[model samples]
Target: MILPIVAYGAQILRAEAKDITPDYPDLKELLESMWETMYYSQGVGIAAPQVNKPIRIFLVDTAQVFERMDDEEKEEYDDDPGIKRVFINAHVQSLDGDEWAYNEGCLSIPKIREDVLRPEEITLSYVDENFEPHTETFSGLTARVIQHEYDHIDGKLFIDYLKPLRRKLLKAKLDDISKGKVSVDYKMTFPK
Candidate 1:
């Protein structure tokens, strides 16, 4: 089932997520629902926080995009783009390189976008659907998306990385969002 995604100003998005346990009932079903929700929302990634579930779990699938591209196109893409990795109780083992900034957005935050600085690559570990432990290295856009979603589980938002000037300009908008003064428009281009 495709669950309704929690929008900006939802308290769950601000609260840190709890770790998932192996014995949790319906774990498999929950992951399926998450994938459905993400696909229905036309998102490349979806975190538990975005679904109002404060749990350390998220999904990413960019396979379709890469699979359709030719060899030259794939070669032009320096990073791995074919894997759909799911993370449960995941943690970043290390970060590499100097701070790099990218325009970041979130499914929870809707249309808002901000320049957030993060590592160019990250090493992370997590459990798969079968409760099997796994670890992988990620870089480029994949790393950026992972870091952004990972932060959500820690009660962090991309706007938290905004500079003083940017924050000031967005203060009213954010305030309005938090107070329910504004509405969520589905057409808004998010993760800007």
Candidate 2:
């Protein structure tokens, strides 16, 4: 099933998510639904909170980004092959390298994109969908995708990184999104 993504102003989107146990009910089913919803929304990453579940779970798939890149762009990220994986009960072990800017957008905040600055590499420890633990380091666009999803679980949004003046300028558009006035191809559940 493709769960309805919670919109930007939903309280759940601003709350820090909790970790889930291995015995969490219907774990496999939930992951399947999340994956379906993410692809349906044309998003490279989706956190549990985006689907209105306050749990420390998220998915990242950067293969499409790399696949769509031109030959020159591919060579630029020669070391980053991209990844498609689930991250559960994740914690950032370290954020290394310099900060870089990327135009980022969210599934919940449709039609709004901003240049967000984040670290170039991140080392994370997380469990797979099966609850097996693993620690991995990601860089380049892969790292950016992970960082974005990771922020959702931490109760942070890309817009939060914007300057105060810029945020003020976008208040109207943000309000429109909160009130379900924005147009998007995917399904969303707006705040009450």
Candidate 3:
């Protein structure tokens, strides 16, 4: 089932998510629905908070535009559907110092976009859906997506990266969003 995605300005999106332990049976089904909802929303990544579930879970599909690739030149890795990765109780082990800025948008934030600087590479330790532990290094867009989704577990948002002036400007719009005074068009365009 495709779960309803919580939009931007939703308080749950900004709340810290609780960690799901290794022995949970519901973890399997939740991960499955998250992947389904992500595909339905045409988003490469989805955090648990985005689905109104404040758990330390996230899904990623990074077969698209990479951070180092030119926006116009990059293409989706293949015609095949993306491989779904379920990261549970994840922790960043290490990361490269080099950073890159990318214009990122969030499902919660509607049409808002902003340049957020993030590590270009990182090593992470996480448990997969099978309860097996694994550690792997990731770079480029994959690294950014990992960090972005990881932050959700800690109650962070892409909007937190905005400069003070930018945040000030967006305050009113955010207010309207949370109050349901404004509506968001969910149509999303993904890179080919």
Candidate 4:
């Protein structure tokens, strides 16, 4: 099933998500649905909060980004292109390295893209779907994707990093998203 993504102004998107155990209700089913929804929405990552579930869970598939990049473009990145993984109860322990800006967009806040600055490296701890815990560091585009989705679970949006003036400039479009006035190929639940 493809879950309807929660749009801007949705309270769930603003609320911090709680961690869940392997015993979470229908955990496998929800993961399947989230993956389906992410692909259908053409998103590289999706958080549980985006699906109206206030849980610390997200999926990242940077292979999609790498596949879309041409050879020349791909060379700019590190040797590791991307990784497909599930993060549950993820927490970023450290963020280091130089900062860089990337064009970022969100499925919940459709039709809006902004250049957001983020650290180049991240060290985090999270568990897999089966409840196996792992602490790992990520770099490059994969790190960026993980940070973006991790923000969703922490009640933060990429737009929140925009300058005050820039965010104000986007107010109208943001309002349109909350009111369900924007057009997107994927299904969304608007707050208004």
lDDT of 2 by residue, 54-161 (tens): 999999999888888888898876345688999999999999989989999999999999999999899999999888999999999999999999999999999999
Candidate 4 — which pairs collide?
Answer: none
Candidate 3 residue pairs in backbone clash: 7-108, 8-108
lDDT of 3 by residue, 66-96 (tens): 4434545455322222234888878889988
RMSD from true fold, candidate 3? 5.8
Over 80-121, each residue of candidate 4 has an lDDT whose tens digit, in order, gives 579999999999999999999999999999889999999999
Candidate 1 vs candidate 3: the TM-score winner is 1
Which regions of candidate 3 fall more than 4 Å away from where they truly are? Answer: 64-83, 185-192
How much lDDT does each candidate structure score? 0.77, 0.93, 0.75, 0.94
79-110 in candidate 1: lDDT tens per residue?
74656878899898999976787777666666
Best candidate, lDDT: 4
Q: Pairs clashing in candidate 1? A: 105-191
Candidates 1 and 3, the one with greater lDDT: 1
> Could you tell me the lDDT of residue 13 within candidate 2?
89
Off by over 4 Å in 2: none
lDDT score, candidate 3: 0.75
